[model samples]
Structures are given as structure tokens and as C-alpha cells.
Target: MSWSVDNTADRQVECDSVAKQVRSWNWIVGGQYRLVDMMGKGSFANVYSAVNITDEADLVAVKISHEGCEDTLVAEAKVYEKLFGLKGVPRARIYVKERRCGALVMDLLGPSLGNLKDYCGHFSLKTVFMLADQMISRLASLHSRGYIHGDLKEDNFILGRQETIDERTVYLVDFGLAKTFLLTNGEHIAPKTGLNPCGTLRYTSLNCTLGNEISRRDDLESLGYLLIYLHRGDLPWILAESVVGGDEKRRLMADIKLHTPVKKLCEGLPDEFFAYITYCRSLRFDEQPDYARLRLLCEVAMRRLDYEIDGIFDWTIRLRDDLEWKRLLALEDVF
Candidate 1:
């Protein structure tokens, strides 16, 4: 059957229906963590705020797979195990399968880039560059571990809690779709076509939209699109969402992404932005990306703008102002 807009709508409704059908339980997991309020929900799992039973002060995020979807959570746990101890990667505490459902406990993180962007309208150039450097580094780390984050979107990258040493750090999460790009013998996997698209339509790479096998380059390309969207508040192909047929919308977006000149997409931004996208598009399926060079482009942009590469992001400033506003409100109340 030809894909239509109804297909996408039906999928969303199905997810919501599934979420509503899944009963929430305050059950204890691993005899240490107790599930509390749900933090988020996805197609296959629900994430809840859990507390360590023995240490009430210890908080974590528990991701519990829906019944019959245990393998998805199990696969994600394996990816986290491979990524353990890597900077910008969350640490997994435990993984358990009980009653046909898998649960994974990990560090609780702050709001996602998507939420922050919504709060601030659009990020400043300085903030974008700051994020670009760190985000590129995070992807490089994942790639070095022989894995590619098949899904790269603003929601997958989150910040650390406020006032902490890692507050400014951008951590990549949600490895449910992660896969190795290398074979067991350390050889690069051969590229293939006719695969299903693996990421969010809005932020997926052109190659991904074409149904090509996802690789490190696809991840980087998706990141480029994400960075641009964060700064510009939208992309040209965003309008494609309103198109009627799902297949037609996808093709339209692919054409827009393919034909849109980097100069036009990076309009009003520094030349480095263009360079970043161009370089990502130029990489071969098996070739290793120049991680250092991509990072250097961001650094160079910072220098050109005379902006200090100090980690104080737009959200940091917003947080400070919010705190001060609350303090003044308290003072007014006392008066």
C-alpha cells in the first residue's frame, strides 16, 4: 500500500492508544529502585522517575519496555554497556527482565534541546557554536566505539541538571536505534539500500530518506540539520509536514534537502556552518570523519565572532534570570 499522511497520523494515534492502555505501576525494580512519576513515554517504552529504596536521596530514570517489546530495551541496554564511561554518555545502573518487560535504570538528566529551544524561541549564534563543538565531540565518541546513533534529533540530546559541574555538558541519550557500523572482524560494513528510514523525518539525513543504510556520515548529517534548526527555529522542508501523502511528503523533503544549497540553508549564519554541512555530505560510507576538523570549525566561528568559548549558554542565562525572578517574588511576598 502507498504511504499516506493517514499512515503517520495512525501511527501517532496507535502510540497514544498503547500508552493509555499501559497501566502505570509504582512497583519496585531490582529491589532497590521504586518507580514514581512517569517522566516520558515512547512508542515502545515508558520512562519514569525512580528513587533508590535504600537511599531516598538517590534519583534515577527507569525505562520500562512495553510487554512484548523487551528486546528493544535489551538492545538499548547493550548499547549503553558498550558506551559506558564515555563522556556525554549516560551511565546505566541496571538492566532486568521481569514478567516479559525489560527495565533499564540510568542517570536522570535535565530538559532536552527541544524543550530549551522552545523556551528561548531560537538559540543565539554563540550558543549554537558552543553546542556544535560539544555535540560533534559526543558523536565522535559514539562513532569511535563502533556505534552510530541511528536516531539523531534535538530530543535525544539533553543537558545536565542545573548548578552541577556537568550542567553545561550536553549528553546524548536514547540509543534504542543504535547499531554498529563495523563487522565483528573490525571491517566496515558494506553499504546497502532498500532499508527502512531509521530516524525522525524532520531531522533525518538525505541518505536516510533515500532508504540507504545508516552510517556515521548519516548521523553527522542529521546533526548538521539539527544544529541549523536549533538556530533558525525551523527548516525549509518543515512545510512538507502539511503535504497530504506520507510518501510524497518524504520525497518532497528529500528533494528540498538535496537541492537546497548549503549557502541558502546556512543563510545569516557564519561560513563555518556551511562548511560543516558540506563536509558531512562529502564523507564516504566507510570513511572515518575528521572529528577534530568539525570541532575546529565551531571554534573558528567563535573566534571570528569574538565570542568567548565560555560554556555559559543561552539556557544558563535564562536559568539565572529565572532564579532571580523567583527570589524577587519571594521578597515581595514577605513585604
Candidate 2:
């Protein structure tokens, strides 16, 4: 199903149905991590706003797999095994229950970049620069550890700890699609042909959509699109009403993405944005990405925007941090 649904009524009904189903799920996962309430539900699993009764002070998100969907949860757990202690990644622990079902316990994070963007309508140039700097660094850090965030998107980069010492820290989450792009021998993995796009198609790189192996550049390019969205409030090709038919609509969106001139896309934004696109586009699938250079470009963009990296973004100026903490605690019992 396409995310670009144009019928407001249908969309609302679909969302409501999903929300009701999510709200109805009150099962305590594995007799622990009591599912306090729903957080979000995806195709394969449901995430709950949960807390360990033994450690109530620290809230957590518990992702429980659907009965028959254990494999994905297991796969994600395996990825987390490789991702533990990695910088910028949220701390995750895996648990298995009866029937081979699984659950993932991880840090309770704040609004995602997508959530923040929706709240603010659009981000300031300074905020975009800061996000770019942090996201590029996060992707670089993950890539250096030999894994590529195969599903890099605005939603996966979430805000962390606005109240404590680690304020404005962005944490990358959801490693269910990550892949080891580099081998332990410090060599790039051999490329394969005819692979389908592995991430969110809209923000996914053109090469990725055309059956290319996932790479560091694809992650960076996805970040580049997210920065543009945060700045402009929309991508150039997101006119949901511009076409008819789901399959046709998806193809058109992909075609626009493949054909849109990077210069045109970044016309009103900073030249650094265009530079990001050019750099990522020029990279070969097996090439190592120069994350330092990308991060430096973002730093320069901040200078060009008459802002510093130290300033607070919209999310940093929280709606109410304690309100969130209280909400988690006060959530109605579903389990």
C-alpha cells in the first residue's frame, strides 16, 4: 500500500482502525515489560509504551512481534546483537517467549525528526544544519562499524534526552533493515545485481531503487532528502493528488525522484544541499563515504545561514519533557 493516499476519509478510517487495534493490545510481553499503552504499530510488530515494574523510573519501548511474524523480530534482534554499544544507536535487548515470539526492549526516545518537523511545520536553517551534522555523524559512525542503516529515513532519527546532560542528542533507532555492507576483513562486500530497493522508496536513492546494493551513499542520500524536507516542509515530488492509481502513482514518484535535477531541488536552499546530492550521486556502490567531508559541509552551511551549531532546535525547546514522562507513567492498563 502507498503512503501517498489522497482520500482523506479513507486514510482517516484506516488510521482509526489501526489505532483501535493498537489500543486493544494490552498483553504484557513475556510476563514482563507490561504493555502500558500503544506507542506505534508497523506492518510486522507493535511497539508499546512500557515500563519494567522493577525499574519504573526508566521508561522503555517494547516491540512485540505478531504471532506469525517472529522471524523479523528475531532478525532485528540479531542486528541489535551486532549494534550493541555502538555510538548513536539506542540500547536494545532482545527477549524470546513461548512459540518463538520475540520482544525488543530499548531506550524510550523523544520525537523523531519527522515528528519534530510536523510539530514545527518546518525547521529553521540552523536546526536543519544541526540535524544534518548529527545525522551524518550517526550514519558515519554506524557505517564505520561495518553496518549500513539500510532503512535510513526521517522517522528513524529520533531526539534523545533534552533535559539531562545529553541534550539535543539524536539517536538512530530500528535496525530491522540494517545489513553488514563491509566484511570483518575490512573490505567492501561484493555487489549483487537485480536487488529491489531496500528502504523507504521515496527518500531512497535512485541507484538503490534501480537494483543496486545498499551502500553508505544511499544512507547519506536519504539523510540529504530528510534535511531538504525539514527545511522546505515538503519534497519537490510529494503531490499526492497529482496522479491516479497506486502502482502508477508510485512509479511516477520514483520517476520524478530519478529525474528531478538536484540543482532545482536545492534551488532556494543552501548550496551545501546541492553539494551533498552531487557527492552522494558520484559515489560508487563499494566506495567508502567521506563522512568527515559531509559533516564539514553541514558545518559550513550553518555558517552560511548565520547560525551556530550550538543553538537549540525546535524539539530541544520541548513542549513539555515532564509531560511526556508523566504520560508514559499514567497510560491506561492494557495488559
Top candidate by lDDT = 1
The RMSD of every model to the true structure, in order and in angstroms, is: 2.5, 6.2
Number of clashing residue pairs in every model?
Answer: 0, 2
Q: Please list the residue runs of candidate 1 whose C-alpha ends up more than 4 Å from where it truly belongs after superposition.
A: 1-24
Candidate 2 residue runs with Cα over 4 Å from true position: 1-26, 183-186, 240-247, 318-335
Clashing pairs in 2: 26-334, 26-335
| Candidate 1: clashing pairs of residues | none
Model 2 misses residue 277 by how many Å?
A: 0.6
lDDT at 159, model 2: 83
Residue range 240-268, candidate 2, lDDT tens digits: 33677654655666778878899998998
- Give a tens-digit lDDT track for model 1, residues 135-199: 99999999999999988888899999766788889999999989999999999999998766777
Deviation of model 2 at 265, angstroms: 1.1
Give the Å error, residue 234, model 1.
Answer: 1.1
Candidate 1 lDDT for residue 316: 84
